[model samples]
Target: MPLKELAERRAILHRKSDPQTIVKHALDDVQLGKVAMVSSFGAESVVLLHMISQTAPDTPILFIDTEMLFPETLQYQKDVAEELGLTNVQVVKPSREKLLEQDVDGILHTIDPDACCALRKTQPLEDALEGYDAWITGRKRYQSGSRAELPVYEKSGRKIKINPLADWNAAKLVAYIEEHNLPKHPLVARGFQSLGCAPCTTKTKPGEDPRAGRWRGQDKSECGIHIVDGKVVRQRNAA
Candidate 1:
């Protein structure tokens, strides 16, 4: 389909429906070359994972294993995907050669998180999504100030980014998880509302922003994926 037609459809869908309706349409779009669900499999990700499992289990689910992630998160990802019966779970990772060149000591999160993230999270996915026309995310507006104005569909370069749960809140996420008996990210109960690389993430305290646990003290809130492209683009916005 032409970009104009898709833009018009996105506008109408954004106004007339709920998250599920919007998500369904994006999955059903035939003109997009390929679509994938980039999930962190963090606290609120189960809602979207479960939705896609039911609506389109065969769709590619890209999970970035930054190699710095929590072990609990790794296990949780495996369990959730299997339990949901989601097929095509692709694990994307940064290359060892690049790590040796750019982040040799592996303490890049201490020196420069954005650069580390670009190498570990963004580039690999960018390579992975060479021809994909769009991807879906679980980001919600209530998570942070930057994402407060997130739209269901965003045109990024030549690709369409889908935030199926853009209107969902903390309570809605909890309700979905409980209602579906979805497994929580292993760190949530310990107060990690957001999960990212182990070196950068911390546990959130009461009254802090939902994503305060991520890149804790750094002024950086995003890992640059949201600003540019790939789960490759799914960077800093999601869990």
Candidate 2:
């Protein structure tokens, strides 16, 4: 099916259902090789990775290594992928030439993070997702200001984006992780409630928003991977 029609269909089915039910139904439509799960391998990522590993260990898992991530995050990604015994994990990366061409100055993120994200993340994944009909994500509505109203399913160009935890809160995510004994990003233990690129993330204070550490002190929230109504907008700022 075309992406728009599939999205419309998904929306119709998810009108009143919860996130788990939506994921269950989406899995039923899987044909083994047509779907993929895209994970940020961030703080709250383990829950969805665990779910997918349990649901379909053989499913291709796409992990985008933005090349700017923390060493701990890269290690965590490797650790989780191995521990879960995920058979088809593929690490996608931005081209070296592209990185050199676009960000040789290394301050593109400082001047325009949206462009940096587009260069390192969005473009790479968009290219990698060429043949996949749908991809799963771990976005929860309560994570940040921008994601406060996320939907279970969304249309992104020619692909279907599924947010299986759209209705979940932080407490629920923590419970799920603890119950599964899931591995979290190492930075999480050091007060980094959220994890992104090394330069863009920081440690949050008590009672600060979970995503307050991302792009700290900057007016950037989301890394442009997910957009709203076809326009990219920052969901939160690291205050």
Candidate 3:
């Protein structure tokens, strides 16, 4: 039941399994206890979503609508769920009271992106994951940064975080999507490789890292939602 022990055990058991098999195990393993899939429904999201749909259509899928997300992303989330027939896609968002108290005017991201992420994303997700013992993520090594050496299974706080596609590369994901005819995020067509909140996300140029567009020109790469290898990075508002 310990995070490390559980993660190591599951990793060893599924060392040779593919992403889909790992997904099935995550959803069906009773030890995981009410596992849920957290998706951004951004570019490259449909692959894992499609996998979950096939493995367990009723699995709870958490989609954090930072509310500052692009209009295209908003619609894409709805379209992907309906297209996949995912039965339990829960829309998570920062509470109105928290928003009013910390990010009134919705411009906190302009001044302090870290605190903004904490209020909008990390805090809300932590609240949403209250009863779940494990959660699935769509992270892949090919995306680079701290994620470059990501493991298939890792311990996040008290929860077991499973990265089914940790080893998958962009080419492999493209091939899989094309082979399965999975739908892509609408912004992908306009060169947005990694999708996040609309204001913080930008278009990734050719030959740049897929996530180069996120928090562009800033020192931040992750939204604190994934600051999880060992440190729990949450920026609190001065207020």
Off by over 4 Å in 1: 1-5, 228-239
Candidate 3 per-residue lDDT, tens place, 50-153, comes to 99999889999999999999999999999989999999999999999989999889899999998999999999999999989889999998786667677888
The CA lDDT of each predicted structure is 0.82, 0.81, 0.89
Regions of model 2 farther than 4 Å from truth: 1-5, 12-21, 30-33, 235-239
Q: Candidate 1: lDDT over CA atoms? A: 0.82
lDDT of 1 by residue, 66-174 (tens): 9998999999999998999998999999999999999989988778788899999978877777768888988888998778777777766568788879888999889
Query: What is candidate 2's lDDT per residue for 1-239, written digit by digit as tens?
Result: 66666767777778788655766677777532267888888888888888877777887789999888998889898899999988888899998898899899778888888889999998898888888977888887777777776777777755678888888888988898888888877778889888888888889899888888787777778888786545676644533
Cα lDDT of candidate 3 equals: 0.89
RMSD of each: 3.2, 2.5, 3.9
Please tell me which predicted candidate would have the highest TM-score against the true structure: 3
Of 1 and 3, the candidate ranking higher by lDDT? 3
Candidate 2 residue pairs in backbone clash = 217-238
* TM-score of each model, in listed order: 0.91, 0.89, 0.95
Q: Model 3 residue 176 lDDT? A: 93
In candidate 2 the C-alpha lDDT for residue 114 amounts to 84
- State which candidate, 1 or 2, has the greater TM-score: 1
